[model samples]
Target: MQFLVKSARPETLKTATLVVAIGEGRKLGAAARALDAASEGTLSALLKRGDLAGKPGQTLLLQGLAGVKAERILLVGCGKERELSERSYRKVAAAALAVLKTLGGSDAALTLGELMVKGRDAYAKARLLVEVLADGGYVFDRFKGDKAEAPALTRITLLAEDTDLLACERGAAHAQAIASGMAFARDLGNLPPNLCHPSFLADEAKALAKGNKALKVEVLDEKKLKELGMGAFLAVAQGSEQPPRLIVLDYKGGKKDDAPFVLVGKGITFDTGGISLKPGLGMDEMKYDMCGAASVLGTFRALVELGLPINVVGLLACAENMPSGGATRPGDIVTTMSGQTVEILNTDAEGRLVLCDTLTYAERYKPQAVIDIATLTGACIVALGSHTSGLMGNHDGLIRQVLKAGETAADRAWQLPLFDEYQEQLDSPFADIANIGGPKAGTITAACFLSRFAKKFHWAHLDIAGTAWVSGGKDKGATGRPVPLLTQYLLDRCQ
Candidate 1:
């Protein structure tokens, strides 16, 4: 879709569709009031006849109005004006787009960016408008015999005042890049396990670097992994016929000597829980285990598109976990790249095994900070549900930076305690530490396990098990989360 920001009057802007906001109690927004006055109280008459209730997400469509140049007028309810919020504003935008999709129009002009959203400026509002529309229009029917029909609406013009035009334009551009990144991430996550295995992800990395001089790609095979003593990562891949891969993406947009920010992603392409098999039911969703890896690639795509001047590295610990004769079993001990021994009491707890090795590998970059993203534990789902990602880290400042980035992008994370006391849960009499940190506080213990290898640098972990994808429904698909948050963090760093 194409997005534009322009200074235009609502009553005179010529477009296939004109979307304006309406507050509760029949209150018209600034744009709506202008259109109402131009049409000699046409909207007021509709409100008097009780044609539309000004509730959030409600909509009323008017066609061929006398004074309106637009072919159609869409009045979207935004609840009370003073109570307008980011969440409600998103609802209003989404509602308007949902209606626009059904119409015959191919272009739209939205005034929602002009509405006041608490704590948000014109740039934020415009950015959010594009993000919401892109999200609603995303469809994954690549494998379907008959693909879903695409939406007719393609061009979206954000109508803003002259003073706000530049800010809105910047937001639209940023949002377009972010949306493309999200679509890439979602595609990788939604692919079938057979097609999106470890090697496949390695190819994707190479493809992303094909013509981009700012990026360099490298893939470490099993031989290199063995040479580097990545036993824990290798053990997870031993059961699968497909080879494992450690995919690295280097982006240098800043000074050569600048310490890069590193992102490590657990790329368990297909997780069958190895020797400790998961329940047969809902196991199909395990393909999304690599959402963490997808998100990293997604962030890189956005960063490169925006041409942000920052040195960054992305590491993908890609593997497939299956329960074969050669698979690592419970009670097995494996050495990690960090030289730390892990006693695997539950093979299902394999995400951290790969991440531990990768986290140790990240120390080579002398990174500014490292953040690992993974679908690490179901306990995170139980604790935080699907609304927020679970966050835990060793450094307080880095954690706060990441937390604030999530808020700014509207992709939130709730920090879990990484207290020293939780480290005891991974105690194993046989090895340095246990892979499964008992049952209680599974989320925190998982972070605690990775924390051991990350002591060399400032590190934070995002457990995205719940927020990665929706399970078993019409809406089931990868959410492409944390990409927005991660990209926003990088964007903030550039400032």
Candidate 2:
């Protein structure tokens, strides 16, 4: 959708829809009061008649109000004037856009950006408004034979004051980039496993680099992986006919001497739990197993779009896990690239296996910091549910940075303990470690297993299993999460 910023009177703006906020107890926001005055107490009369309660997410649509220039007016509820917050503001914007989508309007002028959200400036408000509206309009009907009709709302204009116009414009641009990145991630995650395999991801990396002078792409096939002694990664891919790939994307936008931030992703395109197969129920959602890989690519798309001056490297540990004759079985031991042996007590625990080898490889870059994203364990879902990503790391500073980034982006994470005590969960008498750390604290143990390989540099892990995608219902698809968090982190770094 096209986004524009204008510093104009709400009633004077000629658009298909004019969106304004109404707080509880019949409080009218700045734009709402102006529009109400122009319409001769139309809003007040409706409120007095109890037409709307102004509760959060409540929306009321009116057409051809007396003195308004717009064809329609959309009143979005903002629970309380003093209680309006970042989260509530997003909900209000989303509710407004959701109504706009069903209307006949092709364009809308939103004054919801003018709502006072504590600690949020005009730029932040505008950015969030665009993000929410764009996200609300997203549809994944690519595979549907009978595609649904597209929504009429195609353009959104953020009404801002003269002093805030420039900042709002910048925010709109940033949000557009982020929305593009999210759409890319969502599309990759939504693709069927049959089409979005390890090789397909490598091709996507190459495609993303095409015509982008500052970016370089490289892919390592099975032979190269074997030569590099990535036994742990290979063991996971051995069962699948689709060969494994180690895809590396380098973006050189900063000084050559500066150390880059490395991001490693577990690109298990389709995980069937290998020899320790998962139950058939809800197995279709395994296609989202590679959301970490998708998020990496998505972040790159946003970075390149913004042309941020920073050196960053993305590592995609792409592989598929299936239960085949060649699949690594229980009680098998494989030596990782770090020369640490891992016992495969449960083939289902494969994400860490791929990430361990990739993290070991990241040491070659001498990175300033490394953060790996993965759908590593189901235990993360049990602990954090679908709301937050589980975070763990060896360095407190890096962990705090990630945690703060998630907060800034509103894609929050809860830090799980990575104390030395948890390392015992992965202890194996036969090998340096065990892939499965029993059942308790599965998320922390998985991070503990990776922590051993990342000791050379400051490292953190995002276990996105819980927040990567929805499991069922009408909203069952990729959320394209933590891309906002990751992008925000990098954006903060550039400053």
Error of 1 at 262 (Å): 0.2
Regions of candidate 1 where Cα sits further than 4 Å from its true position: none
TM-score of 2: 0.98
The digit string of per-residue lDDT tens for model 2 on 1-495 reads: 999999999998999999888888778888888888998998788878877788999988888678889998888889876857788888898788878988988899999877888777888888888989887778899999999898888899999999999999989998899988899999999999999999999999999999999999999999999999999999999999999999999999999999999999889999999999999999999999999999999999999999999999999999999998898999999999989899999999999999999999999999999999999889999999999999999889998999999987889999999888988888899998988778889999989999999999999999999999988999899998879999999988999
| Global CA lDDT computed for model 1 | 0.93
The TM-score that candidate 1 achieves is 0.99
Q: What do the candidate models score in CA lDDT, each in turn?
A: 0.93, 0.91
The lDDT of model 2 is 0.91
Model 2: number of clashes?
Answer: 0
Q: List the residue pairs that clash in candidate 2.
A: none
- The Cα error of candidate 2 at residue 189, in Å, is 0.8
TM-score to true structure, per model: 0.99, 0.98
Q: Indicate the worst ten consecutive residues by lDDT in candidate 1.
A: 77-86
Which residue runs does candidate 2 get wrong by more than 4 Å?
none
